[model samples]
Target: MSFFFAALCRTLSPRKEEDVAEDYLSRDAELKVKSQTALHNSHDSVKLIKFADDTTLIGLISNNDESAYRREVDRLVSWCSGNNLELNAQKTVEMIVDFRKSTVPPPPPSVMDSPITSVESFRFLGTTITQDLKWEPTISSLIKKAQQRMYFLRQLRKAKLPAQMLVQFYTAIIESILTSSITVWFAGATVRDKQRLQRIVRSAEEVIGRSLPSLQDLVDSAFYGRANSLTCAGGKSPAEVANTACSHADALNVFRHRCNGKKTCELNSPVFEQDPCSDTFKYMETSYSCVPATHRVVCEHSMAYLNCAAGKVIKVLGADFGRRDHTTCAFRRQKSEVEKIDCTNDAPFVAEKCDGKNTCELRASQAVVGDSCSNTSLYLEYAYICTDA
Candidate 1:
C-alpha cells in the first residue's frame, strides 16, 4: 500500500510542477517579448534575444545601411511604450562590427531624439570586443582589473598566509579574470600583449614565494599536440629578450592579415620569415596563432644633426640644404650657399651612415658634407621616413 501511495504521489508531483512552470512561462512571455523585424522584403531578419527584463537585438547591416537597425530600435521603443516599460536612453549603447577591406562609417543612430553613443570597443557578456577585432584592449582591461586585486593579495601576504592558501586565493580571484576568455582572445593577442598579461601571473608567483607555470605552459600541458618550441638567443639580458620578443610581434601582424578569416593555415610556414629586429642570434621558433601588427616611429632633430632612435633606420625622403625663402627654409642661415640646394642626392650617404645602428646621428656641419656655399649661413632642412629593420 505504501509503495502504491508513493507511486501516486510521484505521478501527481510532475503535473503540479508542470502547471507552475507553464504559468511562469506565460507570465514571462506577457511581461517581456522578443523584438523582431524583416528587411529587404523579408530577405533579412532582425531578431532579439529576450532574457527576463534584458533584451539584445542581433542583425546584419550590409553596405553600412543602418536603416534596418534604426527601424528595429524604433520598434523596440514602441513596444516598450505599449507594454508600459520605460526604456533607458542613457543606458543604451551600440557597437559596430566591420570586417570589410574598406569600411563605411556608420551614421549616428538615435532613439527618442537621444543619440546613442557608438564605440570603437565595448564590453559585452564579460568580453571586450573592438571594431578592428584586436584583443589588446581586452587583455589591457584584464590586466588592470587583476592589478587592482593585487592590493588584496598583498594584504594576504602581510598577514602571513600559507603559500598554498595564497596561491589558491590568487588562482580563484586574479588568475580567473586573466583566463576567463583566454581561448577566444588569446589567438589574436600580440606577443607584447601576452607578455604584459603574463607579468601579472609572474607577480603572483613572486608574492607566493613559489614558481608557477605560465598560462601558455598550462595551455600546452592541456593540449598535448599543440606545444610549440620557443628558443631565445643565448647570453641575452632580460631587456634584450623582451626586445627580441617585441620584434616577433611584427610577424604576428602579418600572420593575422593572412590567416584571420581563413578556415585553416599552417602553423610553421615561410610566409612569416621577415626579421624586423635583425638580431644577431638566430633561433628556430614557431608560432601557433596570429594577431594584428603594431608599428611605432620615433624621430629626433637638433640644430647640429638628426637621429633615429634604436630599432629604426632613417630613410631621408627629401631635404633642402640652403635658404629658399623666409617661410620656406627658416632653418637656413641668413648668409646661405645657393638660394636652394637640393639635398636629395645626400640620402644615399645618410642611409649608408645610419642604416644598421641602433641610434644614428648624422652631423649637419660642413665637416661631414663639404660646405655647399661659402657666404650664406645655411641651415639643414630635411624630412625622412623611418622603417623597422
Candidate 2:
C-alpha cells in the first residue's frame, strides 16, 4: 500500500571569469527531505515519503506478509497524535500497485480508528497518480486546465493586445499548467498523450497569432546547470526558463568543472569564454545524470592502477590530480606542506588514458599532473565506473 501527499548566473564581458557562488534556497527541500528521512527508521520492507504536511508509506509486501507496512502506519498515526496533530482519516487514502495476476485486493489500513479510503487514483501534490502508473489522467487534467486558460488568451487577442503580452499571458497561465510536473510524466507519456499536450500549445499559438515553443522543445531545453535537485536528478526543472535561441559549446566543460561530483552548484554566465549567441537573449540549457562511481586515491609520486572485471571496461567520470585536503597525502608530510589544501588541478589526462580500457595505470607525479602548489604533497583522486565491454 502507498499513501500520497502533495507538495541563475549572469556573465560579464569576455575574459571568462570562473567564480562559483553559494546557493542556499535551492538546498532547502533536498536537505529537508533527507533530514526527515533520517529521523524515521521504519522496517526495510517499508518506505516513507514525507513532503511538507503530506506523508506517504510504500510497502514491498512479499508472501502475503504486511506486518511491516501496518506497523509503520500505526507508528505514523501515533506520532501525529503525540504531536497534537489530528489526521483526517477521511482524507487519507491507500492505493496498492501490484502487477501480479490473479491477486486479491489488500486489506485497507485504518487511520485514527477509521478505515482509510481506497482509491484507484489520487491527486498527490498537483499531479494525478493512478495505481497502474499510467500518465493519462494527469495529462488529461493538464489538457483540460490548459484549454480553459486558452479561452482567456483568445479574449486577450480579441482585445488587440500586443503579441508579446499575449505570449507572456499564455506562458504564465496556459503553458504553466500544461508542463506542471512534466518531468515526472512526459518521458513515459505515450505518443498519443504527448500529442494531446502539444495541441494545447498549438491552440494557444493560433490565439496569440505567434509561434510558441513546442512541448518537446520546452522539455528538452528547460534549464541549464544543476539549478535544483530535480534537474540534477534527471528531472526537468520548471523554475528556470528555457532559452533555446542560444547555444554554447563550452557548457559541458564549465558545468563538469563546477558540478561534476557536488550535490548542488551555481554558475554565472561569464563562465563561457565565448558566447555563441551574443545578439539574442540567452540562458544556459543542459541535462545530466547522477551515477554511482568508485573513488581511487593515490599518493603523490606513486602509480595507481584502475582495473575492471572480465567483460567490463572502465569509464572515468571525473578526477583531480592535486590535493584538496590535508588527510589525503598527509603521511610523513610537514604541516606547511599539507596546509596548502586549495590545490586542485584538472585530470583530463586520466580520463583520456583510462576511458574504455579494461585496465590502466596513472602516475601521480608533476610530470603527469603538474604541481599547482609548490612544495606541497599532492595526490590523484579520481572517480570511475565499469561498463560492459
Candidate 3:
C-alpha cells in the first residue's frame, strides 16, 4: 500500500514532477479522467498536498521494505499489477551506486528537482496541461525526467540553429543540466529506445564537448515590460533566454570559491606557492626561495643568497647566514692579455710605491713588500676571514 502511494504521489502532483513523456501524446478530458481514475484506484487512499510552487507527496507505505529503506521497490508492482504503471526502463537507477560514483565530480542538478513547472504537457479537453501534475519525485523519478529533458535539449541544438547559437545554447543548458560527468552514460541508455532522440542527445553532447562555453556571456534582451521607459522588441521570459548560462546562484558559488584562493593562483608573474607545492622534492629539504635573477636562491625575506643553476631561483635559502653578490654587475674588471715588450721598458723592477686612499704596510715576511695592505685588494685576496677560517 505504501509503495503504491509513492508511485501515486508521483503521478498526482505535477508541480514537483517533471515531464517524462517526450512523445507528443494526446490531450483530452476523456483520456485524463480515465487515466486519473485508473491511477487513483491503484494507489488507494493517498492524500496529496500542494505548496506555492512545490507539491508534497504524502502517503504511508504499508510495505515493511519501504519503511525500512530496503533495496527492493518491486513490492509496489505486485500491488498495482492490474493497472498501467508504465515504468520506463531508462527512468530507474541504482541510487546508492550512482551517488557513490557521482561524488568524485559534483553531480549535476537532477532534472526531477527542476524548479521549472510542467514538462511533457498534455491536454484534457479544451484545457492545455502539463505532466508535473502527475508525478512524485524520488531519485528514480528525477533520473527519468533528466533523461527526457536531455533528449529535448539535444533536439534544440540539432535544429537548423546556427553553429554559434548552438554553441551558446549548449554551454548554458548543458552546464546547468550536466551535474555529473557520469550522467552521460545514463543519458545514453535513457533514449536508447528512440533512435531519433538518441541522435539528438549525441549531437548535444558533441556540441557541449567541443564548445565548452560557460554561461558568463549573455545580454538581457527583454525590456522591463510596457510599464516604464522601455520600448523594445518582443518580450521574453527568463526561460526564453535560451542558451543563458548556468544558474546565477551556482555560478556565484564557484566564482567565490575560486576568488578566495586568488593568492594561491599562479596569475601573472607573481606566484605565491604553498610549502609542499614542489616537483622534485629536492628543494623540500631546506628552506630556499627562488629569486627572479639568474637561477639563484633567496631567503623568504627577499634576500639573495646563492645563484641558482637555472637562473631562476630554485632553492630558497634559509635563515642561515648565506650571502650573495648584488643582482647585477657590482664591481667591474679589466681583462689582462700578455704583451711581449710591456715589462722590458717598465719601471716596475722596483715595486711602485703604492699610494691610494688607503696604504699597504710591508710585513717582515720572506716575500716582497706585499705583506700587509690597508684597504688590501691584493693582500686580502689571500686573507682568510674568520668565517672561512
Candidate 4:
C-alpha cells in the first residue's frame, strides 16, 4: 500500500509594502538568509519544498507505514519553534491520496494539537491540485475567468476598436487567462475540455472580424518547437522597416540545428551565411519551442546506452543524477534511503558531451556525477530527442 501526503505550512506574515520598498534588496537577502537558516533535517520519506512564503512537506508512505512522515511533521514544528516563526496550524492542511480497493481511512494529521483539515483539493502556487490529480476543476476556473473577460472584449468591439487592437486586447486579457498554465494541463485535458478552450479563441476571432490563431497552433509553436514567426526587417524609417521583411533561406535550418531539442540556448547574435538585407538595420525576431523527448532511467552504479537511427543524432533535453521520487530506483533500498525524494543535481555536461552524437554511453556513478544525496542510492535520469544529423 502507498499513501501520497502533502502538508501546507505557513510562517510569519510578510512585511508591509512600504517597508519592502524602503530596502527591497536587503529584504530579499534577509528572506534568503532566513530560508537557508531554518533548515529541515534530512528525512527518509519526506521532502520539504519551499516557494517564497509557503512551505510544503510531501511524503510517500510505503507499506501503509507513516512513521517517517509523522516524524518529518514533528521536525518541521520543532524547527519553526526554534526559529521563532509561527506555524499557523489553523491554516495548515493535509491531503492524502490512497487508492486501495478496501482499506480503513488513516487518522487525520494534526499540527500543534490542532486537527489539520483534509481537503479534496487545494490551490498550490496557482495550480489547483486535487487528490485524484484531475485537471477539470482548474480548466473550469480558467474558462470561467476567460468568459467573464470576454464581456469586455465585446464592449471594445461595440466601441469600434480596430481589429489589431481587439486582437491585442484578447491576447493580453482573455488569452492569458486561458493559457495561464497551458503546458501543465493541456496534454491531460479531456477532448471536451480542449474544445471548450478552443471555443474561446473562436469567439474572439469572430469579434475581431479576422481569423485568430487556434489554441492548437499556439501549443504547437510554443511547446512543440515549431517556429510560428521568423523575420528580418530593415529600412531607415517605420514604413521602410514595415515594408522590408526579407530573411535568409537557411535561417530556419540554422535555428533548428542549434536549438531543436535543447531545454535552453543562447544565440548571442544571429550568424547568417549572408544577410538578406544588409543596407539597413536588420534585427531578427524568432519564436520556437524545444521539441518533445523520451526519457530513460538508469539505476545507480549501472551504465546506460542511448542510440538513434543512423541518420539522426542525440539531442539532450535534460539530465539529472539523483532521485526525484521514491519509486524510480528503489529496489531493495531502505525506506529511509528511498525517501530522499528531493535530491536532484542537474547534469548539463551530459548534454555537452552527448549532443550531436549518433550513440552515447553514460556511467551512472558518483565518479561521473558527484553524489547529491549521501547514503542514498541515486540514479541517472535523462530526457532526449533524436534529430536529423
Q: What would the per-residue lDDT of candidate 1 be over residues 144-190, giving only the tens digit for each residue? A: 99999999999999999999999899989998888877767886677
Q: Which digits, one per residue and each the tens of the lDDT, describe model 2 over residues 1-389?
A: 33322110111212211111122344442211112223383688877776766777777788878878888888877666544355666668887777777788777877757777777887777888887889899999889888887888888898999999998898889888988988778866879999888888887877878889888766654333333233233344443324343456556667777556443445668666676644334456655544456777788889989899999999987887776667767988899889987667887888899999999997888899776788888888788888899
- A best-first ranking of the candidates according to their TM-score comes to 4, 2, 1, 3
Provide the overall lDDT of each model, using Cα atoms, as 2-decimal numbers.
0.55, 0.71, 0.27, 0.73
Error of 1 at 49 (Å): 4.7
Runs off by more than 4 Å, candidate 1: 1-54, 64-67, 99-104, 217-389
Candidate 1: worst-modelled 10 consecutive residues by lDDT? 1-10
Q: Name the weakest run of 10 consecutive residues (lDDT summed) in model 4.
A: 222-231
Q: Which candidate has the highest lDDT of all?
A: 4
Kindly list the per-residue Cα lDDT of model 4 for residues 163-266, writing each as its tens digit: 99999999999988888777777766778999999999999888889998777666644111212222333334554354344556665555554444445544
Q: What's the lDDT for candidate 1?
A: 0.55
Best by TM-score: 4
Which stretches of model 2 miss by more than 4 angstroms?
1-41, 222-389
The global Cα lDDT (0 to 1) of model 2 is 0.71
Q: How close to the true structure is residue 42 of candidate 3, measured as C-alpha lDDT?
A: 25
Look at candidate 4 and tell me the lDDT of residue 350. Answer: 75
